[model samples]
Target: MAGNTDPLSPRAKLAVTAGRAAAAASRAVGRGSGSVIGGKVALRLDPDLLARLATHLDVVLVSATNGKTTTTRLIAEALRASGPVVSNALGANMPAGITSALAGGSDAKYGVIEVDEKYLSTVARDVTPKAIALLNLSRDQLDRAAETRMLAEKWREGLAGSKALVVANADDPLIVWAASSSANVVWVAAGQEWKDDAWSCPSCGGVMQRPGDDWFCGECGFRRPTPSWALSGDHVLDPHGSAWPIKLQLPGRANKANATTSAAVAAAFGVPPQIALERMYSVQAVAGRYDVVSFMQRELRLLLAKNPAGWLETFSLIDPPPTPVILSVNARGADGTDTSWLWDVDYTRLAGHPIFVIGDRKLDLAVRLEVAGLDFQVCEDVDEAVRQAPPGRIEVIANYTAFQDLRRRVGN
Candidate 1:
């Protein structure tokens, strides 16, 4: 159905009403992110509310350790060409968030949902999505997500039961293993520069080789799948060698990878590359991921990276030493209580740079920088850090709540 505007069933209607009331209450009290807590209450009231509202809608679920939020935003924007597409704009990927978006947009027939890595299986099993995009697996929120390998195993279990078409990143061995059991798959070569996550094959402890840049495991013979879509330089290429050039407002290799994977998802749903690419270029930011905002009265580029894999990619975007950069971290519930993943990232590469460390976890990062030989000064306050950073092109990278808190502070 193009537009499913029919009224929700009585149970679902009641759940949605209660959820809206909860959201209103939260907003009234300024207790939390209204998008999250309200939907949680609704799901508690009616566990099956999401399945009911999503029954008649076309759903596309995007799950990844790094790019799912931006990717979902891109896909959701592309799907709007068809009609209204439902999605949570905030980086809310849990069941509550999914229900919140659905309850608010009951009339929308198309959905582009960003799912949390650990919760993807449960959500997919319930939604039976029309398409699934598995970007990459890496250590993220260790306290909350357990480990990446366990996440991969859960994905494998989920895929065995999923009937949806999977758009998987073939560059990462972990993603290949997770989607290997899928009935329908469209592989995309959206580059994975960080090989730390794929140290040994996810399926086998066998050492993997890049035969023609496609990973192949030596022991159990698990291998990289051929990509039907990929990014060749600046152009998005098809399997038959045709290419579509995309000009993005968002920068970085990570974002390009996100855009290419999103195009593959769009293509699986019958959207031509041209249409998807056009909409992708229009996306400037996802809840302030790549926003250029003034902090301490100076314009600075903002980036969010919550884990090692993300930090590695974002670090690559840094120009060089003496280019002012601020590293912010936090150990909030949203950011996971464990800040140990900081040790996993190769901050040694940060040596020879002018760095200003900021956040509640700023001391922890400063210690790591001292060990890595990166000369950095610690400024616990966000505004103070901004005031002290070298006067020039400034870049700020913050994790989870640390980033949100800054966005809120500088928000006008």
Candidate 2:
């Protein structure tokens, strides 16, 4: 049996076959990566395809404004303790991407899905995930996504009907509100380093109280649930109050939080804590989030900064000794067409650091850097910019498309 369920229905097999043919044709023509379009066709042919394919899989669906890609990667690795897993590892979190992942394989007993914040409810409803992980929600793709709380409300409404166990970040008040009524929950105090969007109660519209690890709303009685797994310093503590240090190859406290959250989801699936932690320790990068790529003999660490909150956390990942850093921005639809969010970031933190701005919106970044009193040179090309920087360990941070383009330039 594949994935603990019966074989795909005749309808599902036909849809998957057509989708695969379409994907192969698209790739043959040298079009863009055909992962999405293939799934789109398959889903169009079989409206109930995701549900049908996920029939017997122990599915874990992860959703968040940021870190969903990396977190999903981590969870997939951890589920290796269970069996083979199917997942959308290329950062496509929509239905098509998810359908494509499942369509490729029949041997995978588990499906780890990274769902976009806006598409979480739709996918979760169809997949009927065994565990729904609610990571932090914040401002992202403002032009594409609804307001932060509105998205949370949609999650709350969707989850109310789902019988899946909820694995959630207890530190994010917005996340707490979204998962407060889940039928079964494993609350984790994964630590929210960015709290710009979580200031009020989703139920009563009353300002919430944040006095350290615990937060409670006086008006609506909304409060931070006691955590089952909590992050204390660099370690993740389990339900029995046993703590283990996560030795992840990926740097930064943000990744630490992500690993801890993934571990909690693993526990919900009965995975031993050590097995889950061990698998996560080996993940060096998730779709170039913490990849160290080479460009002219320099080990340039690539990190994604897709939004203001993400930028704030990404800045912390950089060493403070003042090494040369490349900043790239693109205003493509994938990277959020509205580049105005550049002003929303604290570019001032970049002051006194050697900054080389590149990408389609390099000039826009240069203007922001200038206003922040940060010295930066506009480099039209990332590789050329890397060549000009002084020889040392390098950190190159970029938004969505810019990160992808540079990864290709660096030979992937």
Candidate 3:
């Protein structure tokens, strides 16, 4: 029902048509959702397709090392209270996928875009989003995506002088520096679990001082700002001091933070916080993340953790001791070819769980687990790993590509 309302130029229309055909062919051939390829084809036909398609819509861009896809989905669903909303719901954050998504939902009143951390500036320049959500910044895909501070600098430079309202996490120093340059910004006290990458001040390069919950730079005097919205335990407090209990179908503290941010962004677009939170409580999963599906006669709770920061959050979400945990890692290009980051994860926290390692980089993970003094069994695949468990239900934590492969294999 979401279609384009504005009349496109002759070339853009042809590009959209060609992109849809390419996507259809990809789905027919089982190569996957053809979103990237279709967008590639469409862009080849019209280089300015994204900018052209994004015109005349109130757009919101969500970018973060983690939770961008889930947050994007939540924002889109909440904005549905306004009208039909379009989004790249499959976790495709690049420009091509975004263009394809916009092309398909041309008539939708609102566009919720999930942008890659590196591509945020480019997409923002094209779409001119009404509100942009800047979640926490952490080290992820270091082989390709730049370090956290560098990304923060890039975001700061790119967003300078932009008129869009920025809703950013106040708990992260890197995010604080990045969103600081925006003219109109809303800071949310969404807690940051991974602090290793932000020890030094991004502003004056001074050693950051952390006294309990407050963080400040000794040299430059930059400190955590007073947040307009904050997450307190399971409740979200608005700037006016009213507290609302966050009841989301999604589990984990990370998702509660995401919901708080989503509520703030939705409010920026004219939806009230109460209404936005109510609308987001129904989203049980995003793409394939956190999906509990039946696989090999055992209930498998699939969790995606691609970096140390993600793994830290994932560790808290898994089943407790005695419940078997399967950790999958892959060194595919999508999962970051350099598996050295595996050493950064504290696998010893998974000490008591019956841990099983699987995937292409299972041996690499095994070595890290060995160094961490944890016992783990190396398995060939998910079925083999699940077969070794005592049946009933098991937890499976995987990196990006491995997560996708498992989702496809399990038909989830």
Model 3 residue 157 lDDT?
Answer: 94
TM-score of each: 0.96, 0.96, 0.98
Candidate 3 residue-wise lDDT, 318-360, digit = tens: 8788889999999888888999999899888898888899999
Candidate achieving the largest lDDT:
3
| Residue-pair clashes per candidate | 0, 0, 3
lDDT of 3 at 355: 88
Q: State which candidate, 1 or 2, has the greater lDDT.
A: 2
lDDT, candidate 2, 1-412, per-residue tens: 5744556788888999999988899889977668888999999999999898887788999999888888999999999898888888887789998898888668888899999888888998888899988889988777777899999998888888689999999889888888976878889988887776888887788988888767888898978888989888878899999988788998888888999999999888878778899999889888777888777888898889999889999999897747889999998898778888888899887766788989999989888888888888888797788877876888889999999888888877
lDDT ranking, high to low:
3, 2, 1
Span of 10 residues, lowest total lDDT, candidate 2:
1-10
* Candidate 1 segments whose C-alpha is farther than 4 A from its true place: 2-7
Compared with the true structure, all predictions reach lDDT values of 0.85, 0.86, 0.91
